[model samples]
Target: MRQFFVFARKEFYHIFRDRRTLLILFGMPIVQVIIFGFAITNEIKNADIAVLDQSKDHYSARLIQKLTAGSYFRIDRNLQTPKTIEAAFREGRIKMAVVIPPRFGQDFFHLRKAQVQLLADAGDPNTATTLVNYARAIIGNYQQELNGPAALPLTINTTVRMQYNPALKSVFLFVPGVMTLILLLVSAMMTSITIAREKELGTMEILLVSPLPPHLIVMGKVVPYIVLSFINALVILAMGVWIFGMPVKGSVVLLLAECVLFVLTSLGLGILISTVTDKQQTAMMASMMGLLMPTVLLSGFIFPVESMPKPLQWLSNIMPAKWFIIILKDIMLKGSGLREVWPQTLLLTGMTIFFIVLSIRKFKIRLS
Candidate 1:
């Protein structure tokens, strides 16, 4: 036990003594978090739109009011004719144009059917679709108010409040994922490289032959990295909180516990990779291609997991990062407690245990 403490102390020395490693472990996470938090987002705001209200009546005016009220669309121009609307769209002053026919209010009052045309620039299909939905919803609300309930016996008004991210900001999701990626890269990828480097330098044999037990030797090599990565995690969390105003609504202790679990899981993977690959290059490549690629692409970091095909989605279930990201979002954004996120926490814990067991078994086999 005393020997273990001494080795752990040595690990801290190595981590602090190397400036580059220290910075990568600490600086990179904060930078990546800030960059991803601010730069990458899917929510659209203040997209320019044009209105062509030939009626200039109460209905057209109210419709314009609703459009402007929602922060998604902005009135860039008020065109008089169809020619002007077309010209505005052609000139790129507006990506969408709404044309309301003459006597729109009168038609609604008498016939309960007023025609409103939504002309959207389909050059960008996604933006066009969102604009159409926004316009339709706003107009639909007005139509309901205009026409007194003639109606169906039952109405289901399912108002969905996207709780954690009411604005549907992608950054809210990306911040945690990017943090997980950087943690895995630093802790798992770098540790694998370091361990394999020792083997290539023939120093691994020297360490093995030392009075230190094999497990202790491995621990000494990894402990420094663990401390370094922990510091990086803290730096990233600080940047996320300060720079992005990302709230950590859960207990800080719970957040740190989850992060440490994720780091240990990654480190176990690194140890496992080092045991499998003889060369430093092979270890690095395996870490990059085998682990990093899947974690980033398949972990629902950039894409919705539900939208993925059945097989890929099932594969994602085994990814440590996927569970980590879910736990992170629940704790940081939704203020979820241990009770709420226990399932994800348990999943991550199980992965960590599985990875550690596999690595230990592989290491024992290699020793034999």
Candidate 2:
């Protein structure tokens, strides 16, 4: 019994001494609670919207004011022309667009039925539906307000036009996210674990002593993952297109190139993980904590980033999967070209370069 107590005391000291273990036990829960508490939300807030109030009348202005008055919507752009609606959606500027046709107040007062078109970017079906529903509820409430003062109740007919995805298919939205997740986990996690395994088995030391240059050593370790992850991406894309009828509207060549770039970025991230950890378990844990959680929560996979608080939104900018998912959606759903997606492409490229350079530096330190 005394021996058992001493062993337990020694184990507790050992756990306290290892910062990584202490972090897994304490730091992860706090971070997860904070992230999940704030991030895992279905209710949309502060979603940017555009209003093209051609009516420009008293009622139309009042309705516009009503829409933006609450926390649900903010007017980012008051579009001058109807032609720019598609451009705005393509650029990912706004979630929904409100078009009140000419003579909206007159129609409401005289005809009792005024038409308001709600144009929603249904690329994310859930958000699109939620936005439209919120808009309709507001419109309904406004109708009631007018009816309260009138002898007869007025009607506001809302015409919902779901852009990008008229059918509001759920599969369209999940494909890009799943592809990003698979590539990230397979490329980054596998590369880190494989390299860490080499270190654990003492083969990495042998390679470090060999004639192979340090950069090549890292490249050679990650090259197989790039190929495998690319293949994995292609398979997921094929399943999305053929099995689920997901549309690929943009240039296939450009999409393939972007996939390759993302895979390389993920591989670089994995190599960075391997450089810091000698054990496979540590490498896996680091990859999951550092990469996976951020990718899911902050990358706009399941939750909308715009709906999150300001700080989480800012932190989301650092996620590679976020940029890649945007690229995927831009190409696949929006049919966006290099001109539209160049910024995200450049961001991913920069991240890849940064990861590789940092990994090489860390590897050199290990070599010493």
Expressed as tens digits, the lDDT of each residue in 1-368 for candidate 2 is: 45334433544464457686445433443344334434545668899999998999889999999998898999999999999999999989899999999999999889989999999999999899999999999998898898785643676766899988886666677778877876787678777875688778877776666666677677767665565567667766776687667799999999999999999999899999998898999999998888878899999998999999999999999999999999999999999999999999999999999999999888852543
Locate the minimum summed-lDDT window of 10 residues in model 1. 359-368
| Winner by TM-score | 1
Model 1 Cα lDDT, one tens digit per residue, 146-220: 666767678777778787777676767778888899898878887787667777777666566668766666666
Candidate 1 lDDT (Cα, 0 to 1): 0.82
lDDT of 2 at 205: 73
The ten-residue window of minimal lDDT in model 2 covers 29-38
Q: What is the C-alpha lDDT of each candidate?
A: 0.82, 0.82
Off by over 4 Å in 2: 1-155, 365-368
- The residue pairs in collision within model 1 are none
Error of 1 at 282 (Å): 4.3
**TM-score of every prediction relative to native:** 0.80, 0.60
As for candidate 2, its clashing pairs are none
